[model samples]
Target: MRALVLDRPGTCDTLRPAELPTPLPGPGRVRVRVEACGLNPSDYQRAAYGIPEWEWPAILGLDVVGLVDTLGEGVTAVGLGQRVAFHGDIRERGGFADYALADATVLAPVPDGLEPARAAALPSAGLTAHQAVVRRLRVGKDDTVLVTGGAGGVGGFAVQLAARAGARVIATEAAHNTDHVKRLGADAVIDFRGEDIAARVRELTDGRGVDAVVDTIGSDSATANLGLLVHGGGLAAVAGRPDLNAVAPFGLAPSVHEIALGAAYLLGDHRSRVQLSIMLAELLEMAADGRLDPMLSRTVPFEDVPGALVELSGRQVRGKIVYVAS
Candidate 1:
């Protein structure tokens, strides 16, 4: 199998193509013949900063959409030829390769009617959104939610999931992505660079602020979303941590959450894995029903991933970029 192997961690030029033996599953695992792998922020983070736990010449992708090719000991729930998707420590031989071994428990059968690229996007971002809303925040129907970077992968899914549950959502994005955010179900879209996000969210909520907020950009934007939380509201961040002092002015009983979907999945917890699997299944259903969609900005062939990673590191992408495996 051919894969993008990291000879050194920092740049695209260092990712050289190499031939390696196709990996097979071990105990309670399954080997997947990968059809697609979704590029994520974490991918570039690892590529640029270097993961200490990451082995050299390792494959760096985590999101996998593929077919079950072989089963290891104790695997019985899913059979050969079943289509599935999973996210985990592809840190050894990540999903960038044509074959990956995953714990069977980590994979969920791709729900009927879901496209592979779309399915590819669900494991990481969609699961993060689901966990934020359902597990951590427990958002309700009447909630007014605010999402920073609403046009982004996790934020985009957060917007839709919140909207689907009947929450009125407000988003802060660049002017160029304002319309895109609105189309994804935001009741109001504020251009963070130009508009006062906290103020607008306050006005939309009658100076009461929103019931929940997800800050995907983290630092600079955490204050904005924290300010928009109504007293006693919930908050979540995909990118940054909230300063408890900055959140004090809101006078709300604020609960801040950090979403580390990769680490969460890496725990190998059965309950969390099962929950994520169910969430992925429902996310796929939502996509097939048109209630959710991957804002696919680019679809490149597998070999182009190295060059694509260079762009991803610069943080200029608008939506999910999938590698269409040949």
Candidate 2:
């Protein structure tokens, strides 16, 4: 297997080509021949954060759509050659290669209408959005919800899902993406670059703040965005850095939640794994029916993985970027 391995945490140069042995499934796992993989923010963050425990030459991709090559002992759900999509196992080699390992508990069959690149795009972003808006916040009819970074991958999905749940969806994005965000089902789009987001939200809601907020953009602005939520409202943020000091002064006393799909998938417990699998299946079904769109931005050949990482680091992509296996 030829893989783009990260020798250490640093620039794109850290990713170099090397021939490694193909991984075989261990007990309760599956070996998937990679067909397509999605590049995610977490992939770059894992390298940039340079966590002390991370091993050198690590494979960093997360979302994979591939064909099952073999199954490990105790696995009975899928057979060889079935097209599947799942969260790629975090290890020495990942979906950036020709093959990757996956836990059988997380694998979901690719439905008829979903393309491999689109399927690859769904795992991380789709699961994050679903868990944050639908599960954690319990957004529903008549609820006013604000989603930041609304044109980005997870934020776009959050907008769609919240609108689908009948929430009055308000999203913040660059002025150029106003129409793009609106097409994704946002009831109103705020130009984060030129407008006061909190003021706009207050105006939209008749001087009351939103019922909940999903923050995909983590920064000082994200902390202030929390002030846009009504008292006792909720927040589900993907970014961990928020100014905790601002929480109470807002007088909202909001419930804060973080979306950690990878942590739950890697929990190695049967119940957690089963719950993730079910959620993945439901998301895939929605994608197949065209009710949910992964919003694939571009698909490049596997050789472009390293360069794609560089481009993704700039944060210019509006939606998912996929690597199609040769």
The positional error of residue 11 in candidate 2, measured at the CA in angstroms, is 1.7
lDDT by residue for model 1 (288-321), tens: 7788877778788977998887888777788798
User: What does candidate 2's lDDT look like per residue over 133-208, in tens digits?
Assistant: 9999999998999999999989999999999999999999999999999999999999988998888998999999
Taking all chains together, each candidate's TM-score versus the true structure is 0.94, 0.94
For candidate 1, list the clashing residue pairs, or say none.
231-252, 232-252, 232-253
lDDT of 2: 0.85
Please report, in order, the local distance difference test score of every candidate based on alpha carbons.
0.82, 0.85
Worst 10 residues of 1 by lDDT: 260-269
Counted clashes in each candidate structure: 3, 0
